[model samples]
Target: MSQELKTKAHLIYINGEWSGADLDELEVVNPANGQVIGCVPNAGEVEAHEAIEAAHQAFQTWSQTTAYERAGYLKKFHALILEHQEELAQIMTKEMGKPINESRGEVASAASFLEWYAEEGKRVYGETIPTHTQNKRLQVWKKPVGVVAAITPWNFPAAMLTRKMGPALAAGCTIVIKPSGDSPLTAIKMVELSEQAGFPKGVINLVTGSSSKIGKAIMENDKVRKVTFTGSTEVGKMLIQQSAHQVKRLSLELGGHAPVIILNDANIDAAVEGVVASAFRNAGQTCVCANRIYVQSGVHEEFVDKFTKAVNLLKVGNGAEETVTVGPLINQASVQKVRHHVEDALAKGATLLTGGVSLENDGGNFYAPTVLSDVTASMVVMHEETFGPVAPIQKVETIEEAIALANDTPYGLAAYVFTESVSQGTRLIEQLQYGIVGWNDGVPSATQAPFGGMKESGFGREGGHEGIESYLESQYVSMGIN
Candidate 1:
């Protein structure tokens, strides 16, 4: 490891106290340099159980609070996030190798979730069921699901934590958050903010550690009423199996091999720009990032030329620099994974249209934004989620062929289509198998919309009113009067 001074503390929060576990301390490295930037307590089964117990205790009172009362606390929390957005962004950049600009955006996105859900807390509605003209009436009620365990990935730490926690808190559910060990500093600081915002003790807890131990503890805990996770499909499958035994409610936002389709009549310039931003932002670490692109045969060659040029021009450097467009992969393992995918694709006969090599920069986990053309369906990069700055482009004869190729992958979290014809765009949108479809743009999600996936990408929705419902359980009551 490079000799960089670590600035973050190493501790885990349980039962409203910062404590050390018997597990080893995990050093947080900056992916841009492979330098130590912080350390977090690598919690084991013991700490995980403690967090669950804390959340369970907090839920006794938290879940009993009025929706209006919960809304007040969330509003304060939202304002506190805004007050420290810059500090949180810097922590995120140091912990995860995201460009400072993108980190700032992540901070803003986190705050938006809190603000949106704060208002939603007061609006959770229950309906009275209509019955036949008799002396009987039926009422329905929605109540918090007690304790929740939120497992988030390192790709977008701040936003992922808030996206899950905001709705859970708004719905009067106490939570235990287990952030990825790779990037836990920002989340730990956010937990500090929760205390400062005057949230009840034990209402929100943070635990960091190895995935296997922490995940098993959360899934096996009978006190945890629900489990929410965002990560790879393989891990998601294991969590689902574990949750099955306990019959716990689960919300999994798993791996995605998103597709981008460029039509013959589309605006090439606009589509190319969208592809560059969508596929390479945060160095293409996002789950919804477009990994597969199918260009209509009529404009495939031209699109490839422009897309390659754009990838070649990206500025790869430290995330702190304002001019840097692409930052390093989150870790050496991630770099190796990207390299493996690229090398496998080339070995399988795909042609490298632009970049296909790692950078010579010292210490940084940097890989050049790469573009591969003449890619076939058989290549690993075509079917798998390459969580890095690698784009695999393929050509299709028509829109029907493009859609067919897009849907060929088992993962269907998100899809992108660029076209000028409104009628054609609507038709394509209706046929796409993805949960979220972007039309003529690369934006996959907004706070006002629902986001999740179909197929193996996992289930349950987040954002908007639907997000709040995930933390609640419904009960119907019927009464008769003689």
Candidate 2:
């Protein structure tokens, strides 16, 4: 693994060649123990433009390839991801601080996107319209949009890239990806596999370094016809505004403050299990994890008791450790943010049920899996996406109140409800006002399902059949026949 990291480390891939070996190096730190794992070139605006140029040039030929040919390349890429899954998982654990098991799961999820898109590329269907005049024929064809600029987040480094890259490439479009600097190693490794998969030169490129300069450069480039981003709402808004100048296509999967509601007729045991799994996965760093949990007054006390015990069982330590379930936050800023949210909740009269403080002597950015009760709607934790392991739960008197509280947020990414009554579940699902809803399940996202948000959570879907459509443009053709 060390040799693998050194082989491509400190280099930026451009036009199918590795450069920036001597550029200003930025250290990649292991959040687990504050160790410098390796260094990568701090590429800036210049490299970003170069990558865009390369992708633009490649798109001319790459977009001409048949859907079967494009699917072939995607299939190879998917296989390479699974073949090198172990190394990729290790790098992710080192750089991003998710547990080894979770990292492995992410790797699998990442590969699944490529595999699904490989077959889905061939399924991009066109439409035919019957004309009023028998002599005229009209049809619609789907074509590649153009060069795509993908900006991915560090939380699910591998999965986020493949989710965007798979659809873009499968649609016969070239891509220039800018992975988060905090977790660029995993992205670099994935790009390396792309090269080995025999993707044509400039078909796929990656640059790492200052996000601000690269983002600005990509937005300013006329060749980049589409920009896809997954991050905070503030940054997504900026990208949306930047796209207006070129009328560039945009797909933004921004911030989420997901809510989980447990009704009076809910299965308390299953509800507790579901919440624990969803809330603590990736240490609650995921955008869809349950941040605000609401339970009906009839079963609030019992649910809280069981939920606290489940949260306490989560092992917190370095991700490299086999037994550790929860790892450190990506950096100190994340740690501070989590701490601030917890403190604010407590100051606002929320009760700390199990864990609230950072774990001492852990030698890493580890926080105890915390559960809070008596939480109110006005608390900061209720309003903001904590992006940590702290679960702030409130009690609601009725189903109507639970639904109201869940939908009060500006985000409409995901929501969950636990109820044994099928009629009640159906009614709640219809009125949830979220892009994705889980009735009795905590984790509802799958590779085949359309995953995205509404409202402030941003627009566009990433999975199912809708994933590949974002990278394609529809061309209407009208013909006069004798």
Candidate 3:
């Protein structure tokens, strides 16, 4: 199966069949070694429309299927995912450069979404409305939103796609997906599994290639009732503008510069562990990663020392190696961005404690896991989302100062706080302005939790009950009796 997947002529999936095999292909390179492992068809605007039309046609029958039937299909797909977990993880690590262990975890997390939404599909209930007049009967009905367009990022390729696909399918909505050009192989393979799971033709469609062309086609199509996207804020905003004319309902999970606060009363070891896990996971490519670290002045020195030492222990190399905790950046552009942030911080008087150099060699895109101290708000790393394994620590004198600094940014995707005091934790949770909060817990995301953001982080939730709700619409019914 692994050999077949690697050698397969991956193509655009539309109307439940593989196609576009003759089109110009886009090479899929391994970020760890810079080898072209595979190539997918470079679909354009015309192909995007064809996928949309397929989804629209399938919705007529798919949306009418009983929720039980939808759940069954989702469950079958979930089982197939588990069955092929190892192969899926390998493909992900080869194409995207996350450690093999993390890639396996991502596959498990992705499978959970299918199992979860399978159950949630059965629970998409409606309510009876209370009427003022006895002669009139009123009710509220829940329904699938219609054909959906899902635009996902490359970070957690499998998880991101399943997160959107699970709910959209279980809600009885047909979907057209546009996976990131950098990592479409995983998406293509999943779509293959969906076919094996017995999903009806056109119920799930995937197109790869130029992002702008495919994105424009998906957004501008009138048949597409909703758009669900997870990517940069700039791209999300552009999608919003493109879909404006059609007034499409959109669920956007955009950018975030999540902040972590460590108070003097917190367990220094525990705080370090949580921050290291949250900040450096996936080589810090996650949206909710600990971008900024704020430590109270009383314990700032101890915290920085422990954190820097912990970071130094991480082994950075090709993700295929089992011992490597930190992998290369997805591409050279990402490496350059990480380098720029580190350079700018050092120039601004921020002290680098460890790991500030690049590990690029023989086409490898590696950067060292770095830590910076004495960072201030003026530094670019402090304000911008450094989507790399770099942690910048700042010392704050009081809880008020810490909260103020954390909330100062426009992004409100996620924030973490480490404190032993119940009062302090409560206060920080209430005062922090973000969609998701972690109280002494860095890895806070779960398949059953409401995951999203506020302010510039973008609106809409992607997990738990809210995830399915995003693909549904409510209709009020009225009846009159003689």
Model 3: residue 459 alpha-carbon error in angstroms: 0.3
Clash count in backbone of candidate 2: 0
Residues 261-286, candidate 3: write the lDDT tens digits.
99999999999999999988989999
RMSD of each: 1.7, 1.4, 1.5
lDDT of each: 0.88, 0.92, 0.92
TM-score attained by model 1: 0.97
Give candidate 3 misplaced runs (Cα > 4 Å): 1-9
Instruction: Give lDDT tens digits, candidate 2, residues 141-171.
Output: 9999999999999999999999999999999
Q: List the candidate 2 regions with Cα displacement exceeding 4 Å.
A: 1-4
Cα lDDT of candidate 2 equals: 0.92
